[model samples]
Target: MPNIVEPKLISGNANLPLAKAVARRMSMHRGMSVGLVDARVERFNDAEIFVEVYENVRGEDMFIIQPTSRPANDNLMELLIIADALRRSSAARITAVIPYFGYARQDRRTKARTPISAKLVANLIHEAGIERVLTMDLHAAQIQGFFDIPVDNLYAAPIYALDILHHFKDVSDVMVVSPDVGGVTRARELATRINAPLAIVDKRRERAGEVAEMTVIGDVTGKRCIIVDDICDTAGTLCKAAEVLMSKGATEVHAYTTHGVLSGPAVERVSNSVLKSLVITDSIEPTAEIKACPNIRIVPTAPMFAQAILNIWNGTSVSSLFERETLGPIYEGMYSAA
Candidate 1:
């Protein structure tokens, strides 16, 4: 950490813990004295949002940190209003530091004559006065191109790889598995770095919330399998993939997902599944049930995120940050690293 001109940081109600962690790693304590606008979001009789920023934000380098996770509409609107408030108050520059960008998966229209909402979200953020955008593991990398503003898409691969190495003494038998075909590239890169094998879960989506589990692509029998998915919404797919591998004679099964958007019944499914455990990054806030689950775990991405933020703030190269790896035991009280 070098001495640089610190910008005034501000956070919304989306995921304050993550924002605070980022601030702490950067050696800045939030809510010390700076007046922050209180986002009083309410719903009128018609169920429309009414947002207002309570404090002044005149002439400051404002960074609005909101993830737009569950209840995405509310969180997204909150960010828009916050940025609008800053703009009206004449903030020097506004940067939207979203830890998790919602609606990224809808980057393209899989069907005919449908809207590309991801691009629309990008447009809305820009119109809301965002000069730049910073987020992690967008569902589709191409979403970066959709925004004209300077955008940085950070990767959690290095952090995940390092964790895998430290967790298993000999990762030679560990198989980095992609839950579906699209994630093969990501899975392959991780497997190559750890010098481990790779596997793929051939699945057929019969319909929404229904996945038809096909055979495992590579040899995972009697080997440790680590399923990789960008985001685990219901935990159904990952859980089923893990079970399939285990049934196929896999020794153990673990999941490393970047964004843990565990919606309804996700925590319950993971708890009852045959998977040994799950290793997830704190990209989104986990529910109480998700935390209480025996097999579910969380790894903080604060240090990696902090370093990237610092690099951005200081005008340094952050591309090389992807070269590093994160390794450690995912088990609670076993080992922790970023």
Candidate 2:
């Protein structure tokens, strides 16, 4: 057999902490020698992005961990620049481990002249020489097809289920809630995994990021409700849904989201809302305001990202990470040890 190419992990300024954590986990797993690539991604005085890889990457497999979160344009540019740099260095293959895919909300055009920015972004990644993409909880599932290359979309349902079971010792009175009808499928999967009933919040959006009115569809009376969604930007929908759930007699309201794009007044809204707690992953790095918010809690996704990187590097089954029982223990062990 030919010698296996050791994977090289690199990251942009977007969520560097998550990238470092993933590198640490990979290094600790089975005595693997994986580490972050010696790369310097910086911005020029005029705000132009520059990337310089210090170490040799020729014939090596590369995983770039970058989330196009806040300052989406800058972060996205950094990713593209880094990928171009790595490709020029002749890396064997480059996989973008985008924990939170930005521009994803614009996957489709709802109006006459609006652009499908997600497809444009996907094409840009392809042109930048990314061989594959690994993202979690995309806003729209069909965005995967926009890429001609292979795309692996991971779910955070397993992580949420484990956290929920640990938090609510007895889940007998728990209910999974989807803030909008579009998210019923995602919420239902989590509900099924945890053996709980599913609820949907019927809301009409007068415009993007604005919810007109919300009504609870299912009976949440006296139940601990957990709202599940992919992104939590501005948080108007989540907050409104929680308020409606509480009015409908839900005992408590909690939120579990994959990408906490807590932009603008999101932190303030979540802090002042009826939500008992907001659990999010480290897909987007939390700001100081988010950290100081008492009700906000974050679960690390580094272990899962590390495992996925290793699996893809070794040509293993990336989908198996979705198994609840298996995912929980693995996440706990790696996270606890780290």
lDDT of each: 0.79, 0.91
Per-residue alpha-carbon lDDT of model 1 for 198-256, expressed as tens digits?
88889998887799656789888889998887899988888888888998889999898
Regions of model 2 farther than 4 Å from truth:
1-4, 333-338
Q: What are the models' TM-scores?
A: 0.88, 0.96
Give the winner by TM-score: 2
Q: How far is candidate 2 from the true structure (C-alpha RMSD, Å)?
A: 2.1
List clashing residue pairs in candidate 2.
none
Q: Candidate 2 on 1-338: residue-level lDDT in tens? A: 23445888999999989999999988887496767889899888998888999998888888999999989999999999999999999888999999999999899978899999999999999999999999999999999999999999999998888888777878999999998899999999999988999989989878876778788888999999999999998898888889889999999999999999998899999999999999999999999999999999999998889999989998999998999755866777533322
Backbone collisions counted per model? 5, 0
- The whole-model C-alpha lDDT of candidate 2 against the native structure comes to 0.91
